[model samples]
Target: MKDHETLGERLAEQGISRRAFLKFCTALASLMALPPERAAAMANALARSQRPSVIWLSFQECTGCTESLTRSYTPTLESLIFDMISLDYHHTLQAASGFAAEKSREDAMKNFYGKYLLVVDGSIPINGGGVYSTIAGRTNLDLLQETAKGAAAIIAVGTCSSFGGIPNARPNPTGAVAVSDIVRDKPIVNISGCPPIPAVITGVLAHYLTFGTLPDLDDLNRPRSYYGTTIHDRCYRRPFYDQGKFAKTFDDEGARNGWCLFELGCKGPTTHNACATTKWNGGTSFPIESGHGCLGCSEPHFWDAGGFYTPLSAPVVNIEAATLGAAIAGAGVAVAMSSLDRNKIRRAQQAHEKLTVKEL
Candidate 1:
């Protein structure tokens, strides 16, 4: 590996203008929940420190994670490479294959060992001596263990690597297991999603490279900033859910009117992810924004959890009562005007209120 370039020189070589680079720094500071002044400090730290090397390992996965990452071409390729961490070896990205490709990975580990990041996208099948997935005539189990030995910190990239994924489904033939199951000693951070949001993946890596440590993680080892809040908390259709206006069917009036998708098997309330907040495809929209309910792909065991069209949970508390109580107390004039000659509306309101009271 060449000598590490200072941030200023690196950014210059990467062709990122000073102003744009600073804006990137500002975004990073905001994402990290740090103060605006922290941007300059982060810039200083980044300028002095070397660009961290990253080795991406793919095992029993569908390449969805890589697809999500490559779709990160928002502003430009320079943005992805210069701002986020550097990718030293990615079998998918690297042109080399066979012994040459394996040598490149070995070289990266040797050159940046104890400092490079190890990102595994799929699970390791230990059944039958790991013959399920092999590279360069070696099983994934052997390759992963060998790579993890030299990594400074390990990041299980997708649900596959984080939680055994679909390969560990019922009547398992491969006996797949997550990286955490095998490498129990290292600092492993799991970004558990079918294919986690691109921003979140890069955000975590950026946080580690810039801040020199992993961000505060939840009990499930997800970064708190990204996964701390539930999708329901930041949902744009929250008003509909609170108002008890749900889409009963996919093509119903409620769905057409952009109402909530809770009744139709939305897992938003229980799902912890940054999809609703950071968004996808350059902050344009997410699944919920597209009029579809969340599948809870980010949570563990989400695959076998339940159908996407099933209610997340039975309402233990009366949501309608609470919403109506606020409305009747505050919007008295509107309620009074609309209360008359609306028997169906009034009855529905009362039924919800009664349910709420019953719960209480």
Candidate 2:
């Protein structure tokens, strides 16, 4: 593959039809919440643009992030767009090894200079002179600083590189820190998740490729398009939650009926991500749909946010007291209120919404 070849040229050479390419761009545009009209413009921009050089660096990670991006059973648009990039240096995917692999990284840095994208996964261990993790002869800290110097922008993939993930969890043995903590001079985008949704990863890359600039980001430096709304807002079980119907146990009747899992430690109410909409496994289903609560893997310090099975906040309404009086007095209320009239139900729903808002 040549660096000067446009993405459309590459796709055409590989026998992918323009219609298929346009369909992919439309889907990507929708995922990014762009206007319908923007899809055609995006397609045109991306078709003529040269593939950007990407250097993916791995530090103290489990490789789950890489697996999430590459393990799709079929060749979807995400994989195709990923392939469109000039991945000049990737430890796991590159054919070179040992000194040759190191040389490739150096060569890319020299050739692309300040025009290459620097992608990082896993936390950087700065403890013990950053000896907990090393590549070739240099520590991750040294390498990140060196590579980040000439990067057009930095993309910290996964919670590990974004928020210091599990390696930076309790006990703090490694003194692990996120990419943002180390490289302050460059523009950084954090795509946070235990292993981010594959589409979200490609969506960010696609936005950059089409616009030649980073997308609008939230306070956490995450793409606001994907992380703008909380999972609870878009969850299918939200109606159940609003009605105060919840599952007490995994095998309970409420659970069997697809009721809300908020009481069972769902962090959807507070955690923000696109899981509820974009879903996983090619939009087949997300964790909440599989009869489980959201793990809130996208939030910072989620591992230390408390037990996964614990509720986000104490039960806002108690299940023992059963009447509008309980709701008015701000006391405990029943989970099921089938006998309530329409007006009473509306008041109860408003009460619940108010309390949940305060908690969030």
Best by lDDT: 2
List where candidate 2 sits over 4 angstroms from the true fold: 72-83, 314-360
| 91-159: candidate 2 lDDT, tens digit per residue | 988889999999989999999999999999999999999999999979999999999999999999999
Q: What does the lDDT come to for candidate 1?
A: 0.76
**Where does candidate 2 have its weakest 10-residue lDDT segment?**
336-345
1-360 per-residue lDDT for model 1 (tens digits): 244455666777767676776777787776666788888777767666677778899999999998888776332345556544567678888778788888878998998889888999988999999999998899999999999988999999888998887787656699988998999879989998889887778778768877789888876787878876667767889889888899999899999999999888787766778888888888889999898999878766556554667675433233344446657777564664344213322333343334334433
Which residue window of length 10 is worst by lDDT in model 1? 340-349
TM-score of each: 0.84, 0.85
Task: Tell me the lDDT of model 1 at 7.
Answer: 60
lDDT score, candidate 2, position 172: 75
TM-score, cand. 2: 0.85
Clashes within 3 Å, all models in order: 2, 1
